[model samples]
Target: MVPDAILQEDGPLRPNLVTVAHAQYRVRAGALSVVTETVALTKALGRVLAQDVTATRDQPPFKASAMDGYAVRSQDLARRVNPATLKLVGESQAGRAFTGRVSRGQAVRIFTGAAVPAGCDAVVVQENTLAGEGTVTILSDGLKLTRRHVRPTGQDFNCGDVLLKSGERLDPWRLSLVAAAGLDRVTVARRPVIAVLSTGDELVAPGEIPSGDQIFESASHAVMALIKQWGGKPVSLGVGKDTKKSLLRALKTADAELIVTIGGASVGDHDLVKPALAKLGLELSFDGIKVRPGKPTAFGNLKDGRRVLSLPGNPASAFVMAQVLLKAWLETSLGMPPRQDYAHATTTAAIGANGPREAFLRGTCSLSSDGRMQVTPFADQDSSLITVFSRTDALIHLPSGSEAKSPGDLVDILPLDRL
Candidate 1:
């Protein structure tokens, strides 16, 4: 039986919610292939690793001091009859090791991170020692003498230890780890070049005066930011006017593995993205989905094998779908599997029954009084409301035919990527 909900005028039967989420993974669908490249560690941030990152050398290659004091043999500090004192020999500063060795009744001045001198098994912190002419005295502060205060060789990691596995995105902390691994370069997945095209006649770029009834195009800017955040190189194709020629021209200039089209994807008279690309052999995969604010979203590939993900023009719709879909697609192209981005959380307010389409409601999440994860859906869910999305930290997901949810009811949530 044909569902009356999906019997739209000019598009194919809208796919159900499950198919909408799973079937559109064309980046990993034997069309777009993941590419690998070696990049400098400085330029590797936000790029995915194509190979496992191994530590090139042992951290703290030698026994290192964890405190700034004197390095002495433990027997030297255990003097019972005589005061705990030793003759100061030499100083061991960081990156400058002392040549002479420590013997009984002898100590070497060592700073933090300096290599511990040989024949020394313990460190007496400067706070516990009183400096004299050429010798030092360990004060009887009534403290335990068990603390060696020495970082053993390979304390952090050994040479050839796998620190990062394949498909891990390099963030600042991860980059610092790689930098500390004695590496100047690393092999990472080449960022997929994704082109963003905004199509409309009544839209103008920000900073321009909206002459008559035009509004500023905002979705493409947010999409480009998302592309880079998800490890893809974003190429902006600017705005394509509401004409076949305009869209085709913009589409032709997309030298990218994926083209993300915003707006002009519905059955309306001005919706010409499909028609414009049809002239260039646009193959359709899944045309429309049964989801609010993103029903016009579609996925396909062109004759040249470049994949296209058409999104709605509205900023909220585009941004939400980008979080849900584009994030997965880009990760897959970077050799990572699409993550399960949904989890269950308690709703703080009552929610009415959902319509036929599965809805993703913008919401804010926080720990409640008892530390349970709780979410509150925004009052207005208009697809054009960018302000609502700006404050949204999570998306409360309600499947089609879902019953009204009371306060404290558990619901599915998709957390937005704040980065």
Candidate 2:
């Protein structure tokens, strides 16, 4: 039987309260899924690959010399005299190969990366040979005598071989590899456009004079920076006044794959984000995650298939929610696997038992005198304290209903920079 909730045209108007994990799972589904586009190699850095890249041409394309030496036949340097002398025909430098074939008792002066001329199967290093006018002497036949110093054609990779798989981030090393594969461009996933919105009548743009009750709007700026760092293009929609009509008007300009609004998401009388979005045909997935500093966090979808994330109004809360929740959603939307950067560290002080909601406390992470990582959480954990948030290098995560822990207890920490 179809639930009445599902039968509704715009789905549930009320936001469902859920655990943080469940909220994350629902938010990771279709928001900002991978979109592919061709991009020049010069602009491909930091972009995720959308297709399996194959080598267009063989690396090294031909048999090349691996050392600055004389190219000779194995048979000519076989067990003969102590120093076998051969006639030096011509030189083979990189980008210029010796045209003539090397006959018996004849050697070519080949530099590193130079294609080995025909009839030569070995490269005697320059240090292992004596070179004079039109003649060369092989002094070392000490080891096995095959084509040991020649880099065969297609040595690193062969033509048509898959060099990079889809969904791989392009770093400097991978970009170099792509260039070596004779490709001038690559197909990569399009960066998702993220729209950041800050809501509240008390908020004003930064650098503007704030009255006694007004504060500078900040949450959207931080969120935008985070989105850019996480490989998404962010557009700030500025502050939406704390009124249903004003919010609805501001939201009309938010045309993006994911829209993140800061503040006015809770159940307060002035918290009008839910009603505003609900009236605009938003299908509520979940709201009110069970987490500290961000319990009012909400996630849903607009009528046009755009995802909406409503964060807490406080600066610290907004930052933490962005890291813990928005980061995962962005990764999923980009088609990348989830990566947790949590590390274990010993606490330097005692922490009280957690309530029903999970807690993420801002803390300073530093190396102790003994070279072990130590975490010390701040005494004041107020969500509005941006100064405390700035000083902290990591978040100390305590599970729901955890017992009071003393100093030296191991705890999980999520590094601030990783977010």
Candidate 3:
């Protein structure tokens, strides 16, 4: 295994500057596909399936009614002109089918989801009925000739049909469909566990004002929330002071498949994450990415085959790196597809970029009158400004060699959400 620092050697051709695409490629290449198991359908929401879900039984299972109405033979109703009255035989409710077959001139009072009896080809809602003791008359013209509000068996799905594919995330609405297909459980991927540690000697937890030179702690919890949003279980390891022993102990004790350390990957003397990870026999992939606010980001692998990501102390940079790299890594580990909602949008303001690396800018994306997306960068693009990212819906990627983009220029915008 290669040490974490060995991957960052400055080469004449590669230049040691890591681009967003290259960082993502390296992270994805190390993804270990997690194991999977069957979970009850009720608990399967938000989980990715490990196996294709085939319908065990046909949806609806039988011809059924879709409305609270009267079931009748279309031929019997068609024989009468104007409002046609039919004798009411019996009532049919959901889960209990009307066993008696409907002959000519006969109708069954059926509620929604009730199985349609044999010989019935149409249904008329009860609200359109004019009742007279044993008979109900249709009040609307053409109602007797219309075939309405009747659902056929296997209309949704058939037995053995594929309902959901492997690697697909199941939502509550999708779980309902699985239940409709008579499946009580589903096979889904195990959720990835992530351990987060905040490292800094000058930092103190929130609720406690720094007595001397300490600053209020930030970034770890925020990054943890981002991990949760990406479908990973995040465990906060609290704060680790600037010491190799403390950092090393934290990395060794973490019970997660992925360990994240915030604030100690830089070259400062107090930054001990890199050396601590090195002492534990971790193979470093890269120590820095060629992006602003996050150039000091580091990645490595633990002795036990777990992955470790060390992010910058700057809150904004940490968040940007997490969104750009960690999100993709978690998705790949869970067998999910890459997010491709990135599109070109007209820039509403001029912005500068690093000449050699793509810059991700926080911007608000709005639909223009001409039905095009317009991305406007926040006035303050500083790496420490966390508020700017909160108000934005997408990240505007400014490619290399592009110094500044004027208004109306077409720039690539990656949508923050799947929507």
Candidate 4:
């Protein structure tokens, strides 16, 4: 049997009334450093940067025309009391430069993105010019027009400027910027390697019919999907029986920086995970977080500095713990940004709290006719039920010590899809 001291709430961590921020701080402080590698820019999306990316050359690199028009001297157009006739000296297309300069009465036929020729102060759009024998006539007075439709060199960015800072997660748009800055490759933090295991003697794998006392397998695949969604590489460690020896062997052979065990974390006779982890020299960072569907959660670090997170066996509890705890811990360890998008909603019905622990009730949020955020909790919130979570879009956090909430009370909500 596991020692009572290891399973019981002692002095410093007693009361167990921890806020979300406090839990995140503890995980961050204990997170391990992520491995890194250099990958091609095409595969760098969704990966965090390991080093600062600098611009190799100025964007645009030259003064270019913004429209299809004639490049002319602004002073020459201003001096003319009447419409001026100028010769079309040459044409400047993208990627090809015009070698000659423009003189008086000479204008270059330029297209959009073409480099502006020397001595030309403005571009008279082709629409504003009338063509005749060997010359084009400027139609309007051209008073308000200025010299050069030129997009000056380095207008967007200068050379040696930091285009992207270290620790930024690259997305499609960020990749476009890196390509525009002449980068073909990028250095990114290696994906966090995670090992997933499910624990229970009553569970059997799918496709195999269980005996009269056995139930269908649970928690492993669902937890693996969540890990993938959060950008981690998952390795299946299979299911372990509810015994200390089996659990110990699973942890010993798993090759990952992080290990996630599903189920057998509560204070039940069958809860062998806590004892198994302790026997393997795992230091208890904290156990029993003050949250609903996840109150029995456990977090620790192996003697070799790897992380071990023990989540409740129920599918709903496993998912909730992964979202609220595992996501934040992995992101911070890998230098990824914290997800901060949350919506405020008015509760449509009354909600009662259990006790000191904060409860995350599954609910659907929508915009009302008056533009207020409205949230309606699902009828069933049992941790064992997974069907209700499919219909939920947000988790409504109920603060501790609150007995009940009436209609119209504001609640903090975390969106399901975004996280």
Q: TM-scores of all models?
A: 0.89, 0.84, 0.89, 0.87
lDDT head-to-head 1 vs 3, winner: 1
Which residue pairs come into collision in candidate 2?
A: none
lDDT of 3 by residue, 1-419 (tens): 11122122233324665777888888888776868878888788788878888888777788889899888888876656678888988878998889998887778899999999888988888888877798888766536455558887888999889988887788778888877777888888888999999998888999987977888888887889888877788999999989888888888899999998898888778888889988878898876887655788878797889999888988878988888888888888888877665789998776654455556778898888899889887767677776777787888876655656678889888777532
lDDT of 4 by residue, 325-400 (tens): 8888878777776667567898887776445566778888988789998898775677788778878889987676
For model 1, residues 1-419, the per-residue Cα lDDT tens digits are 11223222223434343344554464346335678889999989888899999988899798999999988888766645445878999999999999878877899899999999999887888998889999988777512466569889999999989999998888999999998897878898888889999989899999988978899998898999989888889999999999898899889878998899999998899999999889879888767777776877878888988889888888887887788778778888888866787898999888887666677888899999998999998877777898999899998888766777888999999998885
Question: Mind sharing the TM-score for model 3?
Answer: 0.89
TM-score of 1: 0.89
lDDT of each prediction vs. the true structure? 0.83, 0.84, 0.80, 0.80
TM-score of 2: 0.84
- Over the full model, what C-alpha lDDT does candidate 4 score relative to the true structure? 0.80
Better of 1 and 4 by lDDT: 1
| lDDT score for residue 367 of model 4 | 84
Model 4 TM-score (2 dp): 0.87
Residue 8's lDDT within candidate 3 is: 29
Please list all clashing residue pairs in model 3, or write none if there are none.
3-284, 4-284
The clash count for each model shown is 0, 0, 2, 4
Among these predicted structures, which one has the highest TM-score? 1
Q: Could you tell which candidate, 1 or 4, scores higher by TM-score? A: 1
